[model samples]
Target: MCENNPVRFIDAFVDGLDLDALGFKRVKPKATGRPGYDPSDMLKLYIYGYLNRVRSSRRLEAETHRNLEVIWLMRQLKPDFKTIADFRKANRTAFREVFRSFVRLCRELDLYGRELLAVDGTRIKAVNNKDRNFTKASLKRDLARLDERLERYLKDMSEADTRDDDGPGGDASAKKLTEKIETMKARRERLAGYQKTLEETGEDQLSLTDPDARAMERNTRVGVGYNIQIAVDAKHKLIAEQQVHNKVSDLGLLTETADAARKTLGVETLDVVADKGYFVIEDVEACEAAGAIPFVPKPQRGSAASKGFFVKDRFRYDAKANHYTCPGGQELTQQGGKRVVRKGVHVIGYQNRRACKNCPLKASCTDAAFRKVTRYEREEVLDRMAERLADRPEILDARRETVEHPFGSIKQWMGQGAFLMKRLDNVRGEFSLTALAYNIRRAITLVGIPTLIDAARA
Candidate 1:
């Protein structure tokens, strides 16, 4: 198998194509500092490493020396670990372009379906731990602890000053206590400085290891990590776009992911589907505005289900009358036109306070004075999507099958906390490489490696 390894396609794909064309900066080094390795060669080495799951820089350096397939791929030029690492840092942007290049290549090969797309986010563990991540509350607790410790130190010094007789240990002990007090004071100052840094940056969370990492909750487990969002095409299951976000919520991510898929597919419109997590009203409006139809299931918000009262879905809207009819026979009329509910969000309130006061359903409807149904400014857009979903509810099933495939496959490549790079930017580069490797693996699996190489050659 080593004699005729299919990974040779990776070599042919990297070398035959123009690296500079793919945005990798080519080096034309003069007589200086032991002539740098060509950027393309280093890129080849990384592609090979990622495909084989040998992601460590030091291990890649070892492979250049020993592994026969790698030797053949890199042409016996054994650049050390530092050199290999430097190539990744220097050409981080190139990795992204390379990912796009493969996407375009797949498009040329008719691998991208360009029709149905599923947008989703998966949490990839960051190098930082929960202990390293600091929230404002956590910082306040630390400061409190420091305050107590400082008080304890001051108490010891006060007792020493009043005691008048140094028992057992003598005057040298008092001198040691003075040194310890100074040390404790300095330590308290350092904690205060850290607190100031947190306040100055206005960051809700801080990580000592990976500063960009956040304490994100995904499903059941919470950890210091990044929310990696990707839009996967339904046909060949190629990733259309990959984005790294520190924000934990998938609420408003649908539009951005959908629009990105539209751009990558180079299509005028897209048909997107996601889970209830991405069912933001604004995202649905943006998608429809861009000619893309999103089929996200509207999230079940409010306590109506638990309270046995009428749910939002139970009420019917009258477009002509511009009002809502409750489960009870009462009209909920608009209180105002488009109004700012919060920053960047708008709502129109609907209430029939007089009708509610006299109605029999008032007790079930609200614990408040009356029932107020607030409609978002773009509720019409959501109404359109709801109509779309009622027509094709099976699209949700299609989304589950299409998008989750790539995520499950890629997660197998990343073990527990398996980001090999440190900073957010470097991890982005590393993930780009992972996405490229996955695309290659997908292409080879769909068509043979020989056919893939032949396609690249053409």
Candidate 2:
């Protein structure tokens, strides 16, 4: 007779896993005395789900019923849907801790070298559809609809009143009309209250499906999604930090992601590279202040430079006199200066058109009879940042290698567009798990599976 065969895929995977060493604890002692499943068994379920690309809790629950690996992992114990979902919901904080522990293990394994870090954000579709997004314009339209209904109801009431009363029926009709009017008024009030809340909050319309997520444009073809940002180390392509935001633009993400990378590495400073989308003058200044060297390409809007016309760069600045010299070597005197608000920030503008009209390059410079140029009062600071970026050409190449690797892997693994979770927090947790899983794969590949198993055992 053949020797009894018992070793299975799940058993092989869990052979060396030490749940306590990984910082996973059993549910509280007071929990209903249902024979508590081992935390390691649950961890095995998640790892199997991630490796097989089965991310849904419901799907994972089904896997326990049929999948051979899952059955072996759970020792033929099929958990109900509530048990699986509750585990994920209640263990969110603990799962985050587990994620950090894995990162520490990766560091111990030298998977991340803290040399070059790249930052980028990708939009993931929320459970909410675009039609659900309520903007000020949409709210106005809704209120107009309510107003029209109210007017029609009032007209009908007037028509009913004009008719001669024949009996008690007329009295009942009038009472019904009054009730209808009261109902309409209540609805109108509710709509008005919603409109006021929208206007005062200063946020774009919200998604009822996922309140924490806001619709954001990802690209020309993709719109209305959550922005998920990640910082990846150049060496071994391990994710250093990650965050989810409702912002459409990357302007505010650069400094925050760079600081996260720095904190993760426990280093004073690090080199951070990002694409043009992440470029913001204020963010650049913040990065410089934090001692992190940021390499972000400036976004070239369809201005003079992009249109082949003379750009501000062609004009030179005079530090001593605090004025700009036109391309034609004419002095642009400050005809007037005033502080003005733009994008919620106060900026000073200087203008001088008298010297521009008579200049030989006026045609290439501007269509106005006189060429007018205004600079941000803090333009000097931005200029210094540009100069710094100009000196580091290698940063652009490093950005390609550092940022794209993890994204390529993740996209290949997860497929394109949207996510498995419906809510923003759930999506975030899912993404965190994905990142943790990817880092684990990287760690295993870098230090060898045997070493990681040994560390996990320790």
Candidate 3:
């Protein structure tokens, strides 16, 4: 190996870690049976494979025999693909600690700014195929089609029987139609069972290959996958924290992701920024409570926005007066009969019917007798976040730049567009290694390999 080879850094970095302390299995090795490969060697191999875009255990096994760098890193110990694969499956949870260890190393090297973190999520295709996944709507549609086909087959069988030819061709046609009806009936039974299971469990979708995977939209196309969230530091665009969840949307995930990054960065309070997908008020409040300042743009989603009417944001609320000033300068106080509970949230409606009766802006405001603007009890949290976002509009742009780099690199540059693992746990482990590899490559570029090796030794 050359003097500045990244292999040297990988070897040193893995050797310096206490694998047993990091929850790796078989770190001490058995004294009775045939000697096992050291956990450090296995970890080093995985890190090297992921860094070089060779994620499969079989590929790493091949590399040990063919790739000179792998030979040097493994010291000529050829572990088969099964052994290499078993090591990862057994130590799935421990990979996260190793990732965090490297994050700490980056912190020590001053690679993280620790002042700002950009949180975002991307959908990675799971091992399950789209056909193996079933949703309520999909099942209903399939069953309806099956019924239609079954009815058609029965009608054809009836017509064949009515011909009364008693010849060989007619009998064969009837038998084939019968077989098709039976097959369709069996399929209907299975789909009905899936519908029943969904009804019992109240889950929206079920995946046959990987039960934990969900059908989610990625770039406006639906696929079976897991949501992968990451928090990237603003300085070098390095990933501070990464997590895998089966959730379908990014609505309430901001606080958890940002808080984890704040702890990893070892900061008292960190600035967190994300896109409008994470504009849930409860999550923003929780992020604030966790000591992370969140800046998420309020999503323009309302019936008013869709109907070309004056949206709720156009009406300003007066804190002292506890009333809303509409676009027509009419005071909309809390009406008597408009209090309602929506989605377990107590919302109060405000409307001044007399003002709307003759107001000039009523044409654009509402076409009804009066326009009622409803507010949730805890909407003040959203108000505060809106104020914060108005002040630092550039942070949203910073978030786009900082977070998109890691995801783009992982999907395009790292060749991790789809996961090779089966379940959520395995994919989480896979992504931990992928993220670790990304950070390693980034850190190597920012501050050379020698600096990382020294930090690992210390």
- The 0-to-1 C-alpha lDDT of every candidate, in the order given, reads 0.81, 0.71, 0.91
Q: Per-residue lDDT of 378-438 in model 1, one digit per residue for the tens? A: 6888888899999998998899898777888888754424587778888889889888888
- By lDDT, highest first, what's the ranking? 3, 1, 2
Backbone clashes for every candidate come to: 0, 0, 0
TM for every model, in the order presented, reads 0.87, 0.76, 0.94
Can you write out model 3's per-residue Cα lDDT over 1-458, one digit (the tens) per residue?
88699999999999889899999995323344667888999899999999999999889999999999999999998888888888888999999999998999999999999999999999999999999999999999999999998898888888877887588677787777788899999999999999999999999999999999999997799999999999999999999999999999998999988998899889889889999999877788889989899999877898888899998889999877879999999899987653546454567788899999999888899979999998877788889889998999999889989988999999999999999998889998999999999999999999999999999899
Q: Give stretches of model 1 more than 4 Å off.
A: 1-4, 27-34, 142-191, 302-309, 342-344, 414-416
Question: In candidate 1, how many Å is residue 101 off?
Answer: 1.5
**C-alpha displacement of 94 in model 1, angstroms?**
1.6
Q: Whose TM-score is greatest here?
A: 3
Residues 218-295 of candidate 2 have per-residue lDDT tens digits of 657545667889988888788888877777778879888778777767778777888999776778778867866777
Q: How accurate is candidate 2 locally (lDDT)?
A: 0.71
TM-score ranking, best first: 3, 1, 2
Off by over 4 Å in 3: 27-32, 165-168, 336-345
